[model samples]
Target: MSLHMTGAGALEDPICTYPGSRLPVRAPCARLEGRYLAFLGGSETFGRFVATPFPALLDRRLGQTCVNLGSINAGLDAVLGDAGAMRIAAAAALTVVQLPDAQNLTNGFYRVHPRRNDRFLAACAPLTELYPEVDFTEFHFTRHLLIALHRHCPGRFATLRTELQRIWVTRMHRLLRGLGGRGLLLWLHDGDDSPRSDAPLGSEPLLVSRTMVDRVLRQARGLVEVPVTAAGQLEGETRKMDFGPLQRPTAEHMLGPAMHARIADRLGDAIATLQ
Candidate 1:
C-alpha cells in the first residue's frame, strides 16, 4: 500500500517500492549479505495497511536481518520469473514463503504478465472453446476473467477450476522441491489450514484444495497455516488504507497488524526449529 493523502489533506505514505524490483516491498531493502532471513510472497507479506508487517517484526524479535521480498498481488510467476529476487531468497539463512493465491498464476487456459501476475494476457484455444460466446479480449485481469467465465458457463468454469487445482498441485510440488527443504510454505487467511471449500474458485487462491496442500507437504519443510483471529482482523479498522475508492473493498480483505504479529510468531517458531 503506497502512501496517499486523504481528500481532506492528510498525508499517507505507508507502502514504498524499492529500486531493483518493479513491485512494492518494505522500504530500505535489508542487506542480503550475512545471516539474513528471506521472505517471499504476495500482498500479505508486503504488509499493505499494517504499520509493521511480519518481516520487520520478526527481524526485531530475532535480532537479525530479514529481507522482505514480498510484492503486492504477487503470484508464483512473479517470484519465479524474478531472477534477482529468487537468487537472494534461495541463498538466505532461512526462507519463509507465503503461499499466494493460485488465481494469479498463469495456467494452460491463459497467460498472465510475468511480472504483473494479475494482468491477464492471452486466452488460449482451450479457454476460448470453453467460452466461445465470450470475448477473451474483454478481459484484462485474472479475477475479471474468472468471474465472467463463471457467470457465462458455470459447468465449464467448474472444470477449468478443477484443472487449475491440479496445476497448482504440480507447480507447488516443483516449487518446494526446488527450495530443497528450505521453503516453509506459509498459509495466511481468515479460515482453516486446509483449502476445503464448496466454491474453490470463489476465493483468491482460486481452487487450492486441502488435498493439494497435503500433496505439497511431502516436499515442503512444513506448512504454517495462520488463520487470522477476530481480534487480529480488527487492526485494520482504525488504520487508513492506501487504496483508492475502487480498491477499498479489496483492501478490506487484507490481514491487519494483529495478524502480522501472529505470523511473525509462527515464523519465529519455525526459525527456532531450523536452528
Candidate 2:
C-alpha cells in the first residue's frame, strides 16, 4: 500500500515559510544571545503545528540565547550544510541536536539544491556536479521502502543502514566535539518499535521499544525521549490540528497540538538539565 495518507490539511502557522524550498531560520539576533543552544531537526523541530517550538520555549524558560536551526523537510545534510548554523554551534555554550526519525535520508554532505537555502551553500562549498537521489517527502513512504527493501533484500539494506547510521553518529560526534564537549545530543522519536523484532520485515509496531531506544541512545553522548502519544499534558484534550486535506489519518489523528506542547515541555526540561 502507499504510505501516503490521504486527507489532512497542512498545519498553518507563521513559522512555515521557505526561503527557497529550505525552511527559514529566525534571525540570530532576534532569537539568540551569549552562549548558544541550537536545535537541529526536521518539521517537528521546526514547529509545524504549534506557534512556539520547543527551542523557543526552552529559550523563554532559561532566559538564555537559543537558536532554532530546524527546517521543514530537513534531513541530515541540511544540518551539516548551514554555515550560520555551524558558526552558531561552534560558539554555543550548549548545543541540542534533536535527531529526526531514521526514515529521513541524506548524503554525507550538503549540496546546493535549487530548493535549499543559500545559508547551506555559505556553510559548505564544494566542486561536485553529482547529487544522490533522496526523497524529501512522506516519512511513511521512506520508512516503508527501507523496511520492505531490508526485509526482501537483507544484505543491501543492512549494509546501507549500518553505513548511514555510522555516518550520522560520526558526524554528530564531530559536531558535538566541535562545540567543545559541552552540549547534549538528544534523540526525539515517536515511540514506534522495539529494537530487534521491529525491523520493517512485515508489520508496523505502534510504539518504540526499549531495545530500539537503547540503540539510539548508544549512538549519542546523552539522550532524551518524549512520546507524543503518552505525554501527561496531552493525556486528554479537545484541541484539534489539521494536517492538510491531502493527507490521510486527518490532522487531529496524526499529530495533536498537545503532543507538540508536551514535546516542547520535555525539550525545555531536557535543556534545563544540561550541564
Candidate 3:
C-alpha cells in the first residue's frame, strides 16, 4: 500500500515500504546496515505533523540511522505479531517502544483491529454479557465506543478499565521480553502523569498511571517520558505537516517541533546507557 508520509514538497521525503512491515517507514531504513536505532509507536512517533519527529531528531543527534517504525494508532498486538517489524527492532542496536493507549490492545473484554488498533471491531461475549443494553455496532473507533459506554454505565465500564490496565501491564512485559536487551519503553504524553479518578480512563491511555509505567521499568530507569508543554502544544506550521482537509483537525493535535526536540533530547540521554 502507498503510504503518504509527507505532503508535496520541493524535496520529497524518501519514505517507502520495506519487506515485513505493513506501515511505510522513513526510508533508507538501513535494516541490514551499521549500528542503528529503532523507534516504534503510533502517529506521533511517525512525526506526523512536525518537520522532525523524535526518531529523526535522535538520528541526527547520535549520528546513527534511527529507523522510524511508527504505525498509526498502533498497539502491542500489531508490533509483536509482525515478524518483520520485530526482526528489525531486535536487530537494532537499540529499540524505543512508545506506549500506546491502554484501550487499543486486544483483551478479553474487546478486540481491536489487527493492523489498526484504533478501530473497534467486536466486543467479546463477556463484554456484551456485561452490557447487553448497549449496541456495540454503533461505534467504529475505540474511544467513541468507550465514551458512550462510560456515559451509559460507569459501573460496568470500571470493570473493563481494570481489565485493560491489567492486560496492558502483562502485555507490556511480554513486549519488552521480546525486544530483548535493546528495547526501551517510552511514554510520550501531552500532560502530567498525575492520577485523577475522573479522568477518562477508557480514553487514550485511559487508566495508565505513573506507577504503572514505573512498574514496567522496575527501577531500571530505561523508560523515557516527555510531557509536552502548553506552549509546545501550539507550536506547529501547516507547511511542515501533511494531511487532507478532513484530517486537518487531528494533525493539529500532533506534536510540534518544540515537543519533538524535547523528546529527542530525553531519548538521546536515555539511549546513552544502552551503549
Candidate 4:
C-alpha cells in the first residue's frame, strides 16, 4: 500500500534529520532535552498525508514535548541504523514504536536499500535460487517483489516468510532492549480488531503474525493495538488526506485524520499510565 512516488512537491511536510541520524523526520527538530517523548515508525508515524500526526496531537493532549522521529518506508535496519534517532529514543520518557512490516527488512534471502528500506536493492543467492524464474530487476519496491514471489511460488514463499518473521522478532527485541524497557509496541492493524490471520502476503505490517509479536513483547513496557477497519479507512479518504493528484492513490490507503485522532486518544491514555 506504500507508493514511494512523489508529486509536484506542492505538498510536503517540514522534515529534518538529527545530528547522528540521516533519517528524515518531521521538522522543528527536537533537541536532546529533558522529559520528551519520542515516536518512531514508518509513514503512519511520520503522518505521511496528515497535517498533524498523532505524535504532535499527543503533544497537545499530554502537555509534553513529543518528538516525531518517523520516516517513510522505515524498517528495522533504518531505525536501528539511525544512531541519532536511537539516542533520542533512549533518552526519552518513553518511546512509542509502530510495528513495521517484516518483508521490508534485509535478511538471508534479500537486501534492501540501507536508508529506504522499502526499495528492493538485490536478491541474495538463496532467494534467487528459490525463485530462479523471477528477474530481480523487475522489482523496485519490497512489497511488489514479495507479492510477485508469493504468486510465482507460494510454497517457496513460505520459507522466506518464516525467515522474515524470525528476523523481525530478533530486530524488534534488539530495539526494545536498547530502550531499556521503556519501549511501547504500537500495533497499527488496518482491518479488524480481532486477532490477525496468518495468511501470507496479507495487509500492511506484511507477514508479521501475532505469535511473532508475542515473542518480542517481554522486552517492551506494553503494547497498544489499534485496528482501523477498511470501511473506517475510506470514511473521508479524499476529504481528510493531504496529497497531490499523483499521490492520491497512495494517500487513500493511509489512515485519515479521524484515525489519527483516535490513535492519539488511545496513546494518551497509555502514556498517562506510565507518567
Candidate 5:
C-alpha cells in the first residue's frame, strides 16, 4: 500500500496500511521482522495530538520494535475486523488492546460504520421500535445519537446501555481469544480516578465500567488501567501538545506528552516482566 502523510496532530503523522487491510495506522511502523510489541486502540492509543504516543515511547525505552496499530476512533469492530491489524497483533511479543467504548460498535440496536466505528450509519429495527418517537436521521455520530437518545428517554436508554455493554463484553472476549493469550487489556481514561457506572454521556470508552472490564480481564495476559491523575488533567501540560490552531481544543482534551511518557513508563515495566 502507498504511504501518505496526514496532519492528524502537530507533526505530519504518516498514514500506512497493511497488505490485507486498508485500516490507516501511524507510520514509521515496526517492520514484520524480529520480536515486537503491538498496540491496538482508539485515539488515545493513536496519540492524536501528541508527537510520540506511548507505543513509540516504549519503543525507545525498551529498545524493541513496537508496532502501533491504533486507529483514530477505533472500536472492537475497527480492530477485530481488520485482518491485517489482527495478524500483526497475534504474532507480536505482546499486544496491548485498548478498551474501546461500547457505543462505537454495532449492536442489536444500531449499526456503526465498519471501519470508522464512531460514525452512526443506521438504526436497527430494534432501536427504531424502542425509540419510535426519535428521528434517527438527524444523527451522524454515535455520541450525538446516544446523547439524544438518553435525553429523549433515560428509561429506554438503560435498556440500550445494557445491550451495548453485553455485546462489548462478547466482542472483547473474542478479541483477546484471537490474540492467543498475548493480549493485554489497556484501560486508559482521563480526568477520573476510576471508571464510573454512571459515567456521563460522551465519556471516552462510553458505557464501560470496572465490572465490564473485569469480565474480560482474565482472558488476556493482564490489564493495565491508566487513569489520567488529577494533576494530569491540568491545562499546563496540554499546552505541550502539537496541533494546528483549530486542533487546540481537541489537544486540550487529549493526553499530553507528560501523560504519554507516564503511560510509556508504566507499560515498559509491565512489558519487561513478560519479556
Candidate 6:
C-alpha cells in the first residue's frame, strides 16, 4: 500500500523548513538623536509587571525617547559586554543603571529572548575577554574568599574585602566616565530593615550603609544615587509601602503597581537633578 501526505499536513524535511523568528523592533531612538534617554539594568528596569515601567514614565516626563535595554536576570557582565547594550550606552544623553542585588552575580554574559518576556537562560558568550579575570559568577565570592584568606593567613580578609570593594567602585566609575560625560544615575533597591523571613538574603547589604555610599560617591565622577531604604528612621512609612500582598503570591517577585508608582515618583525626582 502507498501512503502520501500533502499540503500543510505533509511531512517536510527539516533542512528545507524555514526557521521561525521575529526581529525586535529596535526601540525608538536607538541612535539616541534628538531628546534621548537610556535605562539599563536587569528585570526591574525591564518593568516585569506594570504596563508602563519607570523608564517609560521618565520618557513621558522628560519628553525624550527612552530606550530600555534592561534584561531579566542579567548581571553586570551581560550589561557590559552586550553590543546592543553598548550601543544604547554610547548613544544616550542620559542613562540610568540599576545595580542588581549582590546575589544575582554571574560569571558570563547572556541574552534575552524577545518573545518570552521575562524568561532568561545562560548565554554561551564569554565576558572575560572585555572585563579580564573578573569573576561575576557569585556574590558570596568575596565573603568566601575573605574567609579563606583569613583561614590561610589570619587577618587578611578585611583587607581583601576592602580591596574588592574598591575595585568594584573603580570599575563603576570607569563605566560612567565612558558615557561621554552624560548624566549617570545609580539607583539602589534594598529594604531598610533586615531581610524579612520571606525575602531571599545575600551579600549582607553592601550599599545600605552610609560608609559604602560615601566610598562609591567618591569614586564616581558624575553619579546620582536614589536611596530606597533607611532603617528605623522611616519605619512606619516604609512598612506602608510594602507590596507583598499585591504581588501575586505564586507568580510575582517584584514591586506591584502602587509601589512602582512611588518608585517612579522618587526616580523622577532623581532625574530632575540632571536638569
lDDT by residue (27-82, candidate 1, tens digit) is 65776677888888877888776668899999899999988888877778887776
User: Which 10-residue span in candidate 4 carries the lowest summed lDDT?
Assistant: 191-200
Model 2 per-residue lDDT tens digits across residues 89-153: 66767666665443343433332232232222311122121212333232234455455445555
The alpha-carbon RMSD values of the candidates against the true structure, listed in the order shown, are: 3.4, 8.5, 3.7, 3.6, 3.3, 12.1
* Lowest lDDT block of 10, candidate 5: 1-10
Task: Estimate, for each residue in 84-140, the C-alpha lDDT of model 4 and write its tens digit.
Answer: 789888999899999988888989999998777999999999998999898998899
Using TM-score as the yardstick, the better of models 1 and 2 is: 1
lDDT for each of the candidates?
0.74, 0.51, 0.75, 0.84, 0.82, 0.47
- Give the poorly placed runs of model 4, Cα more than 4 Å off: 1-10, 191-199, 229-233
Q: Please rank every candidate by TM-score, starting with the best.
A: 4, 5, 3, 1, 2, 6
Best by lDDT: 4
Candidate 1 worst ten-residue window by lDDT: 195-204
Candidate 1 clashing pairs, residues 3+ apart or interchain: 3-12, 3-13
Candidate 6 lDDT over residue span 90-149, tens digit each = 667677766543322332343333333223333324433433334434323333432333
Off by over 4 Å in 1: 1-24, 192-204, 229-236, 240-247
Full candidate order by lDDT, most accurate first: 4, 5, 3, 1, 2, 6
Candidate 2 — worst ten consecutive residues by lDDT sum?
A: 122-131
Which is better, 3 or 5, measured by lDDT? Answer: 5
Cα deviation at 244, candidate 5, in Å, is 1.4
Best by TM-score: 4
Worst 10 residues of 6 by lDDT: 12-21
lDDT over C-alpha atoms for residue 55 of model 4: 95
